[model samples]
Target chain A: MHGDRLLLGPGPSVPYPEALEALTRPVLGHLDPDYLGVISEIGDRLRAVFRTANALTLPVSGTGSAGMEACLVSLLEPGATIIVGVNGYFGERLCEVACRGGAEVVRVEAPWGSPLDPADLLAAQRANPQAALLAVVAAETSTGVRNDVAPLGPELAGTDTLLLVDAVTALGGTPLEVDEWQIDACYSATQKCLGAPPGLAPVTLSPRAVERMRARRTPIQSFYLDLGLLQDYYLASPPTYHHTASSTLAYSLHAGLGRLLAEGLENVWERHARIGAMLQDALPGLGFELIAPERARLPQLTAATLPEGLDEAVLRKRLLTEYGIEVGGGLGAFAGRAWRIGLMGHAATERSVVTLLGAVRQLLG
Target chain B: MHGDRLLLGPGPSVPYPEALEALTRPVLGHLDPDYLGVISEIGDRLRAVFRTANALTLPVSGTGSAGMEACLVSLLEPGATIIVGVNGYFGERLCEVACRGGAEVVRVEAPWGSPLDPADLLAAQRANPQAALLAVVAAETSTGVRNDVAPLGPELAGTDTLLLVDAVTALGGTPLEVDEWQIDACYSATQKCLGAPPGLAPVTLSPRAVERMRARRTPIQSFYLDLGLLQDYYLASPPTYHHTASSTLAYSLHAGLGRLLAEGLENVWERHARIGAMLQDALPGLGFELIAPERARLPQLTAATLPEGLDEAVLRKRLLTEYGIEVGGGLGAFAGRAWRIGLMGHAATERSVVTLLGAVRQLLG
Candidate 1:
């Protein structure tokens, strides 16, 4: 029953063997001393990876979108104003979540396959001075655009607006210095560059974000995603039970993090950069074109525009069924026009690049 | 790193070998045909287990609490009236979730280790005529009390009050007829009686619950837990991308549910009843008494009161460190007074009962 296809899709890249083995470990009670130790170690390791000493660093029990919701729902109150940068799918999702939270959303846009401009966000901030949060996607999974988060700090400076970054496809693959970048809240999933099975969402909230949530006049709507209670459960001495956390998934995430940290974060980033560059360079030789500009492209996710005559869905299926390779079709604005190929974590290897390139050549050539 | 402890705690009983093996299966994309097949099979299997033909029956991506929040946060809008029956920890949580959702909560109460009186709910329903939801825990894990849900159908027959049951610890271990009992919405976890590791929450929503959610005046506060979007992703013709569902966890849940269905749900329930009776009888012979009344007790969870002067924490610690056995310490109002032993699914066996009994006699004697 095990489907052994080469994972080259936008997420759930091939997990490290040790990490997959961790999933097979005997399940422990969430509060068991052994399991608690795993949770504590994961938190510490996550801080190191995120390059932040924020004590609220831990994995949420759901996937990447859950992390996004946790940040927005906790930091924004109903009637609060949030400035969202819309350049790609995940960025647009931030606007939807903000609107759902009853926040007045001011969206600053760039083209779908391009990075968000800091000047646009600055203008949005000036136009909506009451904006309490500026949300953007650090790495847009849909279009593979990597937004430069460093400039946003100075752009929204001297304002109480907290910066929330969706690091879903960026965290382990790119240089995401949360503390150095001055990001208030950032969330990522394990399936992308972390090389873990999809489940846990690693989220780090700055002291500022925590304080903002603490000062909220209204309680966060969903008790399951409440950051305050989650932090209490993860940080409190003799941690309180906020929910019954999945100790099995936690073990897998911890093992995955351990593998990454062992590889050195810089080395992992360099590997993804190398593999992604190879895929981008080789695909065009097989008649595929890169969608996003090179400078703005994410090393973890590469959105490649299909050749005019090639049917995107048909080719993707052939790659899956014929070559046993999996890659994502485009989403939203880029739908049917592009294909998203992920070079992430364990899947970001020369062999994967060669295998996918050969398969594309076999079918498309 | 695999801690080999006997899981006799309130939940997360030892996963069946097949379920554990399923977790080790190669990961697939969430939208992969193989994975969608798995998801469909799980939905069908869950309906069989839940004893409902409700088309909305499927597992939520988060834990049991996520399922609880999904139902409450979806069915009740801000300022909606929700009367919650609080007889144990989970019931109190229902109240808290309702209040957090901006609902006016009217709590109908009973003692901690007892079931809520059906008459009290009818009165609460009379007092709060506008109440849109009445939530209760079918099996209270904290107190090991199983609330009688059969009478709830007739109590609110003529009203628009939808019943939301937290069957986190009850399903697959007891007789729960979702359609027959006219439950509006019900949720349970993959662990506990399902014999899967804790991750997915199986929730079934009746047509009434779906209609109520569709009629909501306000958008559901939680974008992650919204049942409407989730249904589209799971049940739609071409499933939409809600979030990246964990294929690994889905495989595990499917394998676990298959084991249950293969054994027959009635047989699974009967096995739990027999095992629970054995533990209840044997524990008293060793001078331990069950906290919950026999008639209202859950067969899967036995909250046994400790003998006077015996510190609950110390004894629990000894059982763990000395015998590699894990039983839950008391929670909420029953804290420091009882041990919650779980007999559910693969863990509810003649051997498990004997092993736990032998371990307790060794420690307490």
Candidate 2:
């Protein structure tokens, strides 16, 4: 039996009670009318949570990484040119996925724990004029830096280049306007801020992105992740079978998304901001330091500098073992130096912050 | 609110109670040690269930289709040749996935509700001498035909061509000896015979398949479905994160597989055989005809020819809405003429067959 720990880590955060309840409901056949009804409601609620009117909004059958792969592979053909911003681990991951999708990748770099500059993307666009897609991570979970995406739309406005965003950690917790931001494609996970488990990735594509998919010279390398087929399967009336979807996971997402919309997206974002502020303010007094600059700090995921001489792994283990509180160790450049504490969705609460702070104060003093 | 309907579909049959309870457990962090231990134990149990000592045995994070994608994309490179046996929908799906994975497909045909002859595969091999993989569906869920895989091994004994089996509807339902049958790669879904919710796809690869993956000329096109990385992530002691594995789904599978092992594999298979036999013996007396030949018929999935003048869709809807029972409409060539009734895992009980048969009798009379 796994012990119940307070999940403050990067993801798989404490799921909503409704979501958990939904998961235990009886399994439904993939194409069952009742299951399809629940899934359709999920799409509607997901659109409200995403703040987008995009028709292709539906959860991919895999995790967030699968969503990322779907966006890249569907929009890009082999030998297509894609420019990706590499500010943190997820951005670098975008570059890697673009390469794996058989795209010629041009990377524009920013230091870890910092946001990607839209100006640099503009310059990169000038260099790679034939770029088919430009991608970035809106919330870099590894570094807790949130890139400003508003300026990116104007930079690639006239071109046929489609803008893709990884909103895996940003969607429900942060302020994201997919349509207003001119994001051609965006993908996110159910776990991070959706207050659900980590099995489904909700993705939406703009009409422009769908057009690019339609004109692609080659078939999407993955039949499973093909958006055209998925669009037809999810959005089409009397949906045809593409693959067997987990009705259990879909119901969980439905409940989770319902909770998010019920709380109101703005209120959810504000809760994250308040909880994030509590962590940043109080944890520092307990001998921690904020890692990312305030200008680009992510409200949902906070990367904090560990006090000097503290072993990140040992402290995290102690937190888990002693207090039943879980936090994340750093990755890549921040390894051994930082910890990622997520106050995402249901995990973002005043009581949770107080409990965490009290535990931290006790441990430190 | 979804109604609880009896799922007698070809797949996504009734899930086990323990599996449902396991899914409702508190969500664990993706990399939590306790969760990792659960996953490790799941691997051992999956190995035992698959009856293979293959080192690279783990569940793909998506449904069965994702497992098929992972196998084809990881083993075959662009322009490689693959021969697929097309006896049903899934076999045609195998060809589609292979083609999407950039393999040139040579399709060997058999009519619907019929088994593929090994001689056809031999002739296709002679024609496409450069074929890297021979793919086939072990249990044709659409037609309720179970192919004998024992003959395919000898046909490819000395050749470099690897045999891939889609055991989606076969595993845990029938007697499948992976190593003895010389299956180089096999993938199955949790929802079918595994008695778990449909979220994960359990897959195993032979040493030869692993070697082929290692020697791949191009990178796996989709990073999310890359099995080489998943192998390390699942089997390695200090597993690194490839993608966030859903502890909820993993625990559900662990619980489901444990239930299977606890019941004993032989007893489980026998139970299915017994239940399937019961359905086969009684359904015909209610004016239903078995579509597949008795010799090649699948025990778990029974494709029955609908009586003349009985509407397939109307009867299925009545079965669902009126009697709270569900059965599948036929696919491909069998559509409108057949109904596929599945007796799988938890749904393969004597009580289920009795209820279904009684319902059919009442409706037909």
Candidate 3:
């Protein structure tokens, strides 16, 4: 019954029909040549979607969070300095994971729902010139704010510091250029804009990031996320046995990526933007106030404050139980007072926007 | 095209039809109440399969190796001593991961195709009385060896050390009694004997193991795999958001567990035993020599030496390309000289054995 609910949440947007169909295909062994061909196709399609020529691009075998951990644990060593921009819940997690990896974390703070200032992040990097990585969430899903990764990339050019970006909600729904922006490591999830289920984290690491991982002082603390070993299994010839990669999920992802590329990446982004603007334009008229600043807002995810006197939880429950529309509740600083409406991938359609608006308007009236 | 091939490798055995059908179900948000119901059902079923009543039973988001890392990193802090039994590849990985977590590791060695003697493992534990955990692989997929776990459990009783098991290949295909065997922490993969696609790792921790994790001196290093945080997300009231668990994979695993339970656990186990014995009985006459000793061999996976002067890789490829049957080439020490044939879960049938033996008989002739 829940499967029939229209998913318009912070993640797990409605998956592509092709992806769902692909999942029903019979299982294949991880090392099966045909499965390997599928894996290779996924890699190629990922590179095109990620806009990178990096050979290390492949899906990490967990959710988006695993991708985040994979990039950090693979790059940061004990005593390494990492500058993290904190504007939302995921930004705070970056600092937490980095600190756990024994990295000295320097925080560049921005208010919730506000975009991080790239200048401030650069200043933090200047203060800690030996910083090994400068990380930012390209589109913060928790607050629907888009940090300007483009400004920070050129600033750190030719420096030892790697510019890492978390593009969990941005990869296919918005424009993300990994090589053009000089991002050393970038990770995205399949559930949001990629039009797939929430199981695989498609990640790409630049040659420099791979080099940094290989020159690590200590062995990567987490063997499961070790980039070197993962690369050996995913990219190397005569692929060595690592963990059994999920061929079932890989098939689904391959189908999702194929569908996205077939639709043209720009067209997908344009569709999300057009449909998202339609929702954003309608929210204030329905007594909801938009959270993120206009210029920095992510079109794929819209965060808005609840109408005055509206019991947020009660209204959300009513929408799900009565109207069968699922949206995300606020996270961190915005909890209980905000709702995150997602227009991602296959869910970004005129019908989704109209249906959601009609339900909210009726509830408000 | 590879989807139709018989999966008789070390893992990724043929998935159940119900599980495949479950994958076609529509995607659901991770936090949906109905989805949560499915999660709870999965937990209950996993507890039944693991034969434990531990409240912390749940699936870790990644593969079985992630489960292995989760157990090791959660309980072992820097300077802690762990005694590991290394007989096959997975056992060596246990030492590798524990070492990466900064634990001082003491390894108990055994030959590639032999089981670790319980007396020797006990001696190692006694020598390192301060060991925080003693780990072993219940079913070593690499060499088809089933380490004797029953004896070590009673011997470690009342000791400070917790017993951890890698049940990646042992869970549903063979007999694994977590509570009865006194296993403090155990982990298994879905794709192997569970008749599901490779993605989720069903892991269960005993109350004592949870206590050990809670008392850890250092924070669990891997953020994605931190057991306490994962428990908070999977089992806590009004569940906290940790990672977006893949509902698609969960559905598949849920259906797989459903089929297994419906078949009756004893009946499923008997099927595997009978099918495995049939294959093992016929291998010697077919010019293949069984690798593991009779008492220690796993019923689900049988490792065997290839006929003398026969190229293993060429013959295996012929079986795959010509007969649409997949048998694994040996791993580690057995590489190039042996093959690993799996009779697990849905693939454990007399028909599978007969088809495989007939194919081999023709190929050899």
Candidate 3 whole-model C-alpha lDDT, 0 to 1: 0.93
* Residue A97 local lDDT, model 2: 89
Model 2 interface CAPRI class: high
* Model 3 ranges off by over 4 Å: none
Candidate 3's docking class is: high
lDDT of 2 at A273: 95
| Residue-wise C-alpha lDDT for candidate 2, range A1-365, written one tens digit per residue | 56898999899799999999999888888788888899888888988877788889999999999999999999998899999999889998998888998889999999998888989997898888899999989999999999988889767879878889899999999899888888899999999999999999999998888888998888888899999999989888888889999999999999998888888889899999988988888877777888889999888899988999988888888899999999999999889988999999899998889988888777777
Model 1: interface root-mean-square deviation in Å = 0.9
Q: Which stretches of candidate 1 lie over 4 Å from their true place?
A: A154-157
Predicted candidate 1 versus true structure: per-residue lDDT over B108-210, tens digit per residue:
9999998999888888998888999988888999999999888897677689898888999999999999998889999999999999999999999999889
User: Clash number for model 2?
Assistant: 0
Query: Which has the higher DockQ value, candidate number 1 or candidate number 3?
Result: 1
Question: Which structure among the candidates has the greatest DockQ?
Answer: 1
The digit string of per-residue lDDT tens for model 3 on B197-289 reads: 999899999999998899877899989999899899999988988999999999999999999999999889999899999999999998899
Cα lDDT tens digits for candidate 1, A3-34 = 79799999889999888999999999988889
All candidates' lDDT scores? Answer: 0.91, 0.90, 0.93
